[model samples]
Structures are given as C-alpha cells and as structure tokens.
Target chain A: DVKVTQSSRYLVKRTGEKVFLECVQDMDHENMFWYRQDPGLGLRLIYFSYDVKMKEKGDIPEGYSVSREKKERFSLILESASTNQTSMYLCATPGAGGSYGYTFGSGTRLTVV
Target chain B: SQQGEEDPQALSIQEGENATMNCSYKTSINNLQWYRQNSGRGLVHLILIRSNEREKHSGRLRVTLDTSKKSSSLLITASRAADTASYFCAPESGSQGNLIFGKGTKLSVKP
Candidate 1:
C-alpha cells in the first residue's frame, strides 16, 4: 500500500514561533499538497509542489510556505504562528494529471497559542 | 475561495440503512471524488467520477455527477456501523494539482 507519513500528529507552538510540518510519500508521486482544514470552512489549499524544488501558492497562502527539496518529501512551514493558524494540516500526493486519487497523510492538528 | 460545498452538515442512520450526501461546486472540474475520514485521521478515497461520467459505483457506494448542474451525490447502501465517518467531496480544479474539498458531512450509523 502507498503511504504518506506526516511528521507530527499534534503540535503546539507559541505565537510568532516558526513551525515546520513534514510529509513524505513512498509512491514517488510528482505532486504534493498542503492544506489547512477548519470547521465549517473545509480544507483550503495553502501550497502545492508539482516537482522537486518547485512550489506554487494556493488560495490561502497568506502565512504559510512550502518546500519540495526532495522528490519524496514535502514540507510546510509556518513563518510566524498565530492563534488563527490553529487547525488541522493535511498533506497529500496525487499522481500525474490526477489519473489516480490522492494519498493523504494522517493530519497534524496544530494549536497556536 | 472554496470551490465546493456539501449539503447536510450531519446525518444519522441505523445500520443496514442507506445514507446519501450531496456536494455542489462553483467551477468546472475534471473530476469529482468522494472520501471518507475517520475522526482525526487521513481521508480515504472512496470513488471518483469524471466530468463526462454521470454515475459510478464501487461495492455499496454509488457516486453521481452532473456537470451541467455542477453537483454530485454519494450514496452508501446498507450502511454499516463502520461507515460512521465524515464524508468529503473534492473537485480537481485547475492544473495546480490540488483538490478543493467541501466542508464534509458527518455520518453516524448506529447498530
């Protein structure tokens, strides 16, 4: 089975602190994505990377950034954590042209205090 | 902006009953997918219906898409207690390789 592993399941960070969430997929997928899910708001994309070292901002990329330094790993960074940033962060990888469904990582619930 | 919205924020049913959820999107899409997510876990892909296809089925799950209406529906027949989870509908929009997910409908199946 394909696996998408997230570095943390739960995290707490102070305001203004920098945070990192890691995701790795073993499927050699070319596309990786980061999303933040909130109650009543659904999952909003923060960023996505289609290839190694290439990234693009999604709808809600205000305070978040992404890095795809390796083909199998994608990282989401919170430059300055804030209370509003508290939410469930999900990572997913999709096959080329979305021919197959995405494989998601166990989300990380972040609480910014 | 959110591309999709799911109707009926929550639903409850007895085991062996059927459950249905609806999703509507604002933009054109290449495909619509249904996913199941247990509490605090990653989402499991259930089914995907292409824009050109009207309906698709897998096991007891049925998915229908109406491109003209920009809507989709998921139906699970003879739902089991294990079917209790949050169901989300996502649309593959643009070429950015990201899925736009709906808020999800929480389903509870009691034995």
Candidate 2:
C-alpha cells in the first residue's frame, strides 16, 4: 500500500509565529500538493510541485508557501501565522500519469492562538 | 469560490439503505474523482470517471458523470455504519494537474 505521512497530526502556534508542516510520500510520486481544509470550504489547494524545486500556486496561495526539495517530501510554510490560518492542512501525492488517484496524508490540524 | 458544489450538504440513512450524493461543477473537466474522508483524517480515493465515460463502479460505490450537465452522482448501496463519512468530488482541469474540490456531502449511517 502507498503511504503519505505528515510530520505532525496536531499543532498549536502563536499568532505571527512561523509555522512549518511537513509531508512525505513513500511512493516517490512526481506530484505533491498542499491544501487547507475548512468546515464549509472543503479543501482548497495552496501550492503544488510536480518536481523538485518546481512549484506552482493554486487557488488559495496568498498566505502559504511550499517547498519540495526532494521527490518524496513536500513542506508547507506559514511565514506569519494568523488566527484565520487555523485549519486542517492536507498533503497529497499523485501517481505518474493523470490516470491514477491521489494519496493523501493523515493531515495536520493547526490552531493559531 | 468553489469550482464544484455538492447538493444536500448532509444526509442521514439507515444501514442496508442506499445513499446518493450529487456534485455539480462550473467548467469543463478532464476527469472527476470522488473521495471519502473519515472524521479528523485525510481523504481516501473512491473512484474516478473521465469526461468521455458516463459511469464507473468500484465495490459497492457507483459513480456517474454527465459532462453535458457538468454534474456527477455517487451512490453507495447497502451502506454500513462504517460507511459514515464525508464525500467530496474533485474535478481535474486541463494539464495543470490540480484538482478543484466541492464542499462535500456528509453522510450519517444509522445502525
């Protein structure tokens, strides 16, 4: 079975503090994505990387940034956390072609207080 | 704004019954995928149907796509209590490889 792992399942950070969320996939997929899931909004893509050092902004990329230094790892960063940024963060990896579905991590629930 | 919207935000059904959730999208799509998420966890892929295809099925899950209408429906037959979860539909557009998701439908299965 393919596995996607997140560094943390729950996190709490002070407002204005820098926050980092890590994701790793054992499948070595070429595509990785970052998304924030809210109660009524579902999941909105923040950023995605198709390859190492190559990233693209998604629908909601204003307050978040991402890093993909390795093929199996992707990281999401919050330059300065805010109360509004508190939500469930999810990371996913897609198989080589567009034919297969994505495998997602367990997700990180972040609280900005 | 969300590219897709799911109807009947919530549904309650008894075990051994069928549950249907609908999703409507705003634009053309290469493919539409359905996923299920348990409480406080990540999503699990359910099925995917291309724009050229009309229907697809996996296990007890059946998915139907209507490109002309830009809508899709997911039906879970003889659902069990374990099937209680949130269901979301995502549309993949063009070659960007990014999926635009719907708000999702929360289903509650009563035993």
Q: Chain B, candidate 2: TM? A: 0.96
lDDT of 1 by residue, A16-105 (tens): 999999999998888898988888787888999889999988888998888889999999999999999999999998744444588899
Candidate 1 stretches greater than 4 Å from native: A96-99
| Candidate 2 Cα misplacement greater than 4 A, ranges | none
Which window of ten consecutive residues has the lowest lDDT sum in model 1 chain B? Answer: B91-100
The DockQ-derived docking category for candidate 1 is: medium
Question: Pick by DockQ: which candidate is best?
Answer: 2
Whole-model lDDT per candidate: 0.89, 0.91
Model 2 chain A worst lDDT window (10 residues): A93-102
Kindly list the per-residue Cα lDDT of model 1 for residues B1-111, writing each as its tens digit.
Answer: 336688889999999999999999988888888889999888888888888899999999999999999999999999999999999998877765368887899999999
Model 1's DockQ?
0.74
